[model samples]
Target: MAANKAFRFFDLPPELRGAVFSQLLVSDESIILHDTTFFTLPSAGNWNFLNVFLVNMQMYQEASAIFYSMNRFTLNAHSHRLPVHLTSRGGFLSEEGKDARRRVRNLTLYLTRVGGEFERVIGPALSDMVLNGNLRELVMRLGPPSSLGASRPPERDMEQRPPFQALLRLLADPYLEKVKLLAWKAHLAIFCPFHLRINSSRTDTESVDNQGIAILRNSTGWVELDWRAMVDVYAPGQKIVRIGDRTY
Candidate 1:
């Protein structure tokens, strides 16, 4: 009976095995690799099967080159290898062992400043991936400003800070069609309203600050601003600068 069984999985043929492996890797609900329940392995749980995979020469050869897509890489103070591997690989995907690094669309960057030093070297390859690829959405949440100490700075610096420019540059993407800012603080807010007409159709155009409102007005696109800071909207033939909404 044991000999009759004859390693059922191995006997199924290489193509079948490869197909199954691909399905397992791509499955979102069934084959989970991250945070899980009691039955499933935890993120930090040791992967003992890795050694077994490495032992079989043919398996090792296949596994060595295989890059699974639709994967999640989590990181923290406790473990370091998971992030390192994903970043080193540049988050590239292998569709049956074909490289597709330039096709990545979604990214969640959680960067932290450790011991007053920014760790860019943690993932140089990933940066290459972004630079070389077509990125549709870039969600970056930098830990915090390293320089903001316990003591607050002068009021003049706050007003003069170029936070708006930095944010605009950060959010700009020529291929980007949709943009969303989760929670951000800055000097100016630029809104490109959905399906807004550029040509004149008088609807509260007067009384806005000319300089502040001119940039967005001339652009021919419109978006509703949800600003945390105070803003001044300016347009041509406006007597005085004024901010209508307290919170937008």
Candidate 2:
């Protein structure tokens, strides 16, 4: 009888080993970065696979990079729920935290409002990420307008809106390659490339309307989205600045 040969995980080719690691570690949903812990939403099923990084030093370096670089992290911008402290030096990141921060490419900021206070807390953090970290794409999720009950003009100019102005400033950062804006009420999705020129006098409503029409005409999955209502809300006078391609 032949003796059973010892099997080794490292014996596999690098590509195959990487594929296996990706299957085990990659997540389809955005990873929630709450406080100091990193986890996928409960809907993605409970997973404690981070411990796999502790198997050995070689695995630690390779897997940790994949974990941080591949996942999209959602950071809450609300003052009460802000996850990390921003400092002039490096904030409160540990060695591993620093590595992860530097490796992370995509980030989403969930904001209660796009007011000055929100900018104060979030602006610096974003600047830090762009300047210090390797952030490639950014998504801003703005909550519904607080003045939904108040009587306001049917259409306000985009330049006059505080939130819109804040958004323009946020997108001015050259480091970000892609930017997406989502408003709760409008269900509006604005996709912008890095070089998009924002014209204060121009409203993006028409462009977005056309884009939405095109999406509905061509896209089979997003037929349920109310593109007309979204376009109408901004029709009065609200202008959407010229951005990148229409994502949907």
Candidate 3:
């Protein structure tokens, strides 16, 4: 049985094709799956983006699962449209696109410096993913903190983007503020991923260790996280945002 002279890409064995996808697409550092960065390709220093999956349907079918399942994704505190990007209809509203969202395994969320008056539906948007996305890892990155004026306008990449309709109902609900236990927390509380890490940083080297949002960062710093114990990493696996890179 001789090989066909007209060997196309499909002729390659499934494993070989997957190797190609991983080689071309996977990132050693976590990928940023945040607002604006999702549709448009942001400059991420040679890391692969979803555009590579646009080759065609068959290629998408073969390569996407590998991409989602193998690599870690970072969702910032401001990524309100997470459901659209992850478990909802997606930016394209395609079945395959939604399926891709459901396949993500390792995820990181930046939850430390939420300085605004309102919190984005970051947790609720990801409810479906945590429940049924076949996710295997969940990493949450918390403080060093930020001051009131720290956040900027949305166009400046500082303000949070809008939330998708997938979780619209939960957006304005006061249950979170009133009850003190977040709606999304219910989903997260039940999640048991294969791997979970929580990394935090701080600076307590000065007399004024913490002042409202203005927490000091110095050579002396330590962290203690007890609000919620769950899996982690971030730009939301953030900047791998080092959780160590910032001050708490």
Q: Write the per-residue lDDT of candidate 1 for residues 217-236, one digit (tens) a residue.
A: 33322233322121222111
The prediction achieving the highest TM-score against the true structure is 2
How do all the candidates rank in terms of TM-score, highest first? 2, 3, 1
TM-score of model 3 vs. true structure: 0.49
Q: Which segments of model 3 are wrong by more than 4 Å? A: 1-6, 35-51, 78-100, 113-120, 144-248
Candidate 2's C-alpha runs over 4 A off are 1-6, 41-46, 78-99, 144-167, 186-248
Which scores greater on TM-score, model 1 or model 3? 3
Kindly give the number of clashing pairs for every candidate: 14, 4, 15
Q: For candidate 3, write residues 132-169 as lDDT tens digits.
A: 56554565544323312343322322222333222222
Q: lDDT (CA) for every model shown?
A: 0.34, 0.54, 0.43
Weakest 10 consecutive residues of candidate 2 by summed lDDT: 213-222
Q: If candidate 2 were superposed on the true structure by all CA atoms, what would the RMSD be?
A: 10.3
> What TM-score do all the candidates reach, one by one?
0.36, 0.57, 0.49
Model 2 lDDT per residue over 1-248, tens place: 34697668898998888888877777778877653344554344666786788799999888777777777887765443444543223442333345456667888876654555555545655666677887778887654344222312222353346544545655555567777755443322332111122444643332234222111122222112222233334333434443353355
